[model samples]
Structures are given as structure tokens and as C-alpha cells.
Target: MTEAPAPATPAQGGEGLGDKGLSGKSLADHLREIEFDPRMIGMVAALAVIWLGFDGLSGGAFLTPRNLWNLLVQSASISVMACGMVLVIVTRNIDLSVGSMLGFVSMVVGLIQVRLLPELWGFEHPATWIVSLVAAVALGGVIGLLQGALIAWLAIPSFIVTLGGLLVWRGAAWWVTQGQTIAPMDSRFRPLGGGIEGAIGTSASWAIGWAICATIAVGSVVARRRRRRFGFSLRPLWADVAIAALGCGAVVATVMVANAYALPAGIARRLTEARGQVWPEGGLVIGHGLAVPVLLALAVGVAITFLATRLRFGRYVFAIGGNPEAAQLSGVNTRKVVMLVYGLMGALVGISACIATARLNAATNSAGALDELYVIAAAVIGGTSLAGGVGTIAGAMLGALVMQSLQSGMVLIGVDTPLQNIVVGLVLVIAVWLDGLYRKRLG
Candidate 1:
């Protein structure tokens, strides 16, 4: 009798052993088509490299719990602004005036909080903060609206409009402040920036971290269920589990680091003295958990992501960026969409200004100088396309973190200021160049 021939494997055109057949395409093709977001993966790897590089140079000080916590806090403003900038870029528009807008709005906030409210009422007005917050955000939006209108209705290029606003707003800020600094910001506002006196404590940190993880898991489950109801392809169960597990791990790691550096020496001593207790030889009190500004950034990121991914407006943005004529033909109201994008950006600018001013506990004429460059770099480095129709809030957040980490690491490594700027500028250029090459490949 002739020996039985063995069945061919997947490579030989037969399905692989125990193939599920759920994937309609051939195994190889299915593997190739599997969804994977490279931007975030690359960002995480880049961040890891930065941490390792800086740790080595700083003798491990760079990754210390305190330093890492401080890093997150410091990056919060840039991160918040980047969230809004993502939408702007996705619509194929750029706002060079964000830095100037921030400075100008911050001065307005300062005038209300430090001078106008107090001087008018002789004592801090009870409702000053409430009114100031509204006014700041609204004023920023109006500025953006005017600039966007010029671009949309008058046929002015966005670059030109925002560039003009950049000069105009900065000059306005300088004139308002007269080159002076405004200080003694509101008590309630300080905590929003995660100042030393107003950060979350240890318990709250862990709670917030775990809560975030839980919320993400729930959101994932809901999304999966909705997709299934619509008969969309669902990822394997293992993938969902793995993703949730990774998110939990990340949150736990962040909380652990913050806990490790709970209290600094001076703060510990003050606590001990206040409690009338003898301080231990080298022990420090646990100061606090995650900073408030980090939480603010997280909240803003969540809101922006929802707006971008779940709304018709966001869909219109991508459509317009991809093909303005087609989008207009589809009744997308291209001009209004672009205008709303810039308007939203202005509001975010106001928010970022508030955060930065609170952190410094002062608003200076130069508070946001060069910040527009940093914000744009964050969005680009986070994987936003300059040509539009591509970006994510998550990517922008990670990009802001990367930029801040580089700056902080450089400071620790004692790199010269000029050299640092040169390095950052090169990174931005390289990022844009790589993106261009990527688009060319697709073409």
C-alpha cells in the first residue's frame, strides 16, 4: 500500500493546524491586516530610551519617584494644549499663536485675580475666580474665532492669520503687564496646577490610578459590545485581556513611583515640627500623591479624545483635511468646521495658560514665550500629520511627555541651553522628514 500523504500546512495552501476559519482571509493575509497602532508603541519605546539614557547620565536620579512625579506635573500644560492642537492639525490648519494666546490670556486671568478683583473690592472678591475662569476661556475663544474667521471668510492663510495673532497677542500681553509679573494667584487656582501646597495625597493617588484603569476597562467592554451589536469584527478575547492588564500595570507603576517619593526633606521636617513630633534621623513624611495638574491633563485628554473620535464634527475634520472639495460636496461646511477647530484651540490655550500660571504662582509677560513651538512639536512628534487627517490625543499626550522628559533630562545632565534647543529643533525636523517619507511610501 502507498504511504498516506501528509496534509499541507498553511504555508502550503492548506489551513494551519487547528485553524479557526473565523478569519475569512488567508492566514498570512489576516496576519498582515491585523490592527496595530505603531505611533503609541514607538512613543513608549522612545520614552523608555529617554528614561534609560537620562538615568545613566544622572546617576539614576532622573527616574527617582520625586523627579518622575515632577516631570508629569511640568508636562501637564503642554500636554493639555497638545490635545486641542491635534484637532487643529487634523483639519490641516496650524496655530502659531498658541504661545501668544496663552500669554495674553494668562495676563487677563492675572489682572482679574491679582489686580482688578482685589483692588476693586479691597479684599479678594468671593466670585473673582469664577468670573475670571469664564472670561479667560471665552476671551481666548473669541480671539481664535476672529483669526479663524479671517482665514475662512477672507481667504487669508491660517499660517498668516495665526502668525499675525502671535505678534499681536504677545505685544498685547506685554503692554497689559508692562513687562512686569503678576503674583499671588488665587488659593483655589493654585491646586489646579499641582503646586507644592495643593497636590493629592498618597491614598488619593492610588485611588485615582486604579479608577482610571477600571474606567478604561469598562470603556473597552462597552466599545466591544457595541461593535458586536453592529456585527463588526472583534479582536480576540486574549487581546482585550492583555490590553487591560497592560493599562493596569502602567497605572500601578505610576502610583508606586509617586508613593516612593511621598515627602521631601523640608516638607517632612515641617510636618514633624507642626505635629510636635521628633523627626527620625533620615526618615521623611509622605508628602502627597499625583499632582492635580496631571489629573487636569488626564481629564482634558479624555474629553478631547471623545470629541475627536465619537463626534460627527471630528469626522468632518478628517474628511475636510483629506479632501476639502469632497467634504464640501458632502455638505460638511468646511469653513465652519475649520473655524470651530481654531476656536476650540483658543479655549485650550486659555486652559493651558491657567495651569502654567498657577504652577509658577505668577503670570509674567513672557510666560508663554516659545511655547507655540513646543506645542506644535508635541503634536507632530506624537504622530500627528502636518498634511492633516492623522493624529490622536493619546499620541499628543505621549509626545508632550517625551518633549518635557528630554528637557528635564537635559537639565539634569547639564546640557547647555543652546545645545538643548538645537537638539529639540533637530528632533522636530527629523520627525517631519520621517512623516513625509511615510506618506510617500503609502502613495
Candidate 2:
């Protein structure tokens, strides 16, 4: 009877079972074959749920154009720092002092602009903003270098070095202005913090969106061609097309949302008057396309993503993280890479400081208090494993958005400060737990 049994049909798991057809593979199988990161899918789904839940609880206020626009601006600084944190975590290092570093650098920049530069260049001098920014960034890099040196050259642990830095820098920040706040920053510099004047126009936003879409499409095609030329395994053409479509669609949707958020009537009227145009019977509806800080964050994300994915330095960092002894034996300059990663993290923190100071129009010793937690949480939530050698800049950026979204949503629902902290702490713990499970499954 066994010898006489019929051969297994395709439906019963024969060769054609793996074929790409309705009769063979299910949708889930097709998705699996496309090699999409399941974690990313889960994150996106979770974000959708959060948004929907918040919008419902907030009586539809959470998803409005104005709220969304403000949310993006608020998220800008955290997103910027998270980009660098991805690298720091990727190399098995931590920077507890970033928040304090941000405060110190911001205080210094504020002093230079508000109290020092005006004395020399006169009020609102064009060069004041540039000089202040450069100095702030340089100072941040120097601080990072010092801390990294202590860790790398002295063979001290990063946790100890940065923990000391956290205290030292916070005290330094207070000392910069003797616990006073610096205010009324340079006029040109204020836009970096993203008020009504900080936005690029609707036309420019659309142009940028289109350019990004074109790049995605072209890049996908080039990647596919390169894979074919090198005889590497290729994703299905349909998968590539689907990915490109989704990316372009997202860009377009974002641009549209930004363009939909209109300027305040008074601001629009004043702008028209300043331009020597008569105010129409109906107020002009000028859109706040995209904030400068948001654009800066985006640029950082793109640049960091490229650096991490396409550079020798990045490879060395990851190699060191994967196995430090092996990487050192293989001739990787592990110390140099580690030092450089921290330096880069410091530079990013500097940028975040500027954005925060500009937004508030003031800098205080507490400007970035607790921000290190947010940055680290964003990186962790975005899939930067604490075990190191596994992370993505895009994921980190998305994670920053998720973190900001939660806080913003909580605020809208009138959640207390302590509760917010508790929630954030819980989220960070859960993210790490999930990451451990993911790693274990892979192992």
C-alpha cells in the first residue's frame, strides 16, 4: 500500500509549494520571501495603533495638521541625537553625558551670541550665529575627545568616564552663566528652533519630496542591477517596486501634511504687509511647509545612514562591537574608532543643543536635563541592540518619533509628569526585553 501511494501533490508540499502563485504560496510566505525586517513592520504597526488611540482619546486633536507639525519640530532634537546614539550603541559604548554636554554647549553658545558677540559685531550681526554655532560644535567635540581619551587611552570603562562627565559637564553648564539663563539669541539663529518664520515654503517642500522619491526609485533600480551584475541573490522585482512605491508615497504624504498646516492669520497678514501687499478680504492661508530643525534632523539621518552603511569606519566600528579581540587582531584600530564614535556623538549633541536653545529663545543650565534618557531610549526602541553590532539610523530616527509621539500624546491627555517618566522607563525596559528575545531567536 505504501509503494502504491500517489506522489505528493503541490498542495501537499511538493516542489511547486514554494512557487510564487496564488495556488502555491500564501501572502505571509510571499512577505517572508521578500526579506522585510519583521521588527520594522511591528514598529510601524505599533505606531499606527498609538496614533489611532491618541487621536481617539484626544478627541481628534492629536492628528490635526497643526499638532502634527508641532510634533515634528519638537521631535527634531531628539531625532538628531538618536542618529549618533545608533553608532555609539553599535560599537558597544554609552554616553551618559550627552544631556549635560548639550546643556554646557548650549550655554556657551548662548553666551557667545547674547553677551559676547553682540559686544563686538553689534546686535543681530549676521556672522554672530555662524561663529556661535561653530564654537559650540567645536567645544562639544573637544569634550567628547576628552571623555573618549579617558576611556580609550587610560583603558577606563566608558560608563565610569561618562558618568563623571555627566556631573562635570552639568556643573560646567551652570558655571557658564552662574546659574542664570541667556536669552534673546541672534535673530538669524532663531529659525533653527522653528517658529513660524523657520519654515520653508510649500513649493520647496514639494520639490524636496519629489527629489527624495526620485532618488529612492533610482537607487532601487541601481541596487537591483548591481545585484544582478555581481550574481548576488536578488529580491523579486515586485518587492523592489513595492518598496519604492511605499517610500515615495510616504514622502509625498509627509509633504502634503506639512503643506496643509497653515500659518496663523495674524502672522500671514503681517507677512503680507511686510512684503508691501494689501491684505485680501479673506486671509491668506500660507502653509508652514517644513521647519529648519526638522530638515536638519533629516539631513543628519541621511548622512549618518550613509556613513554607517557604506564606509570603512563604520565597518570597523561594527567589527569591534561584534568581537573586540578579533577585530583588534584583524588590524582594526579599535580605540580610534571608539574615540571617533564618541566625538561624533558629541557633535550631534551640539546640534541638538542649538535646536533646543533656538526653540526656547533661551539657554539654561537645565536645557537638556534628562535628554540623554530620551536619546538612548530612541536608539534602543529603534532597534539598536545593547549587545552592539546591530542598528540602523533610519530605525533610530523612527524610534525618536515614536518616543516623542508617546510623550506628546500623554501631554495631550493630561498625564502627570511622574506618570510620563514611568511610562518612558517602562517602554525602554520593554524595548530591551524584546530586543533580547529577537537576538536569542537569531542565535
Global lDDT scores for all candidate models: 0.84, 0.87
Backbone clash numbers for all candidates listed = 2, 0
Question: Which segments of candidate 1 are over 4 A away from where they belong?
Answer: 1-34, 120-126, 265-284, 438-443
Give lDDT tens digits, candidate 2, residues 20-51: 34345444445566767767876787788888
Best candidate, TM-score-wise?
2
Clashing pairs in 1: 262-287, 263-287
Clashing pairs in 2: none
Alpha-carbon RMSD to native, per candidate: 6.2, 5.6
Question: Model 1 — TM-score against the truth?
Answer: 0.88
- Regions of candidate 2 where Cα sits further than 4 Å from its true position: 1-35
Candidate 1 lDDT over 328-389, as tens digits, reads 99888999989888888988888888889888888887888899999999999998998888
Error in Å for residue 275 of model 1? 8.6
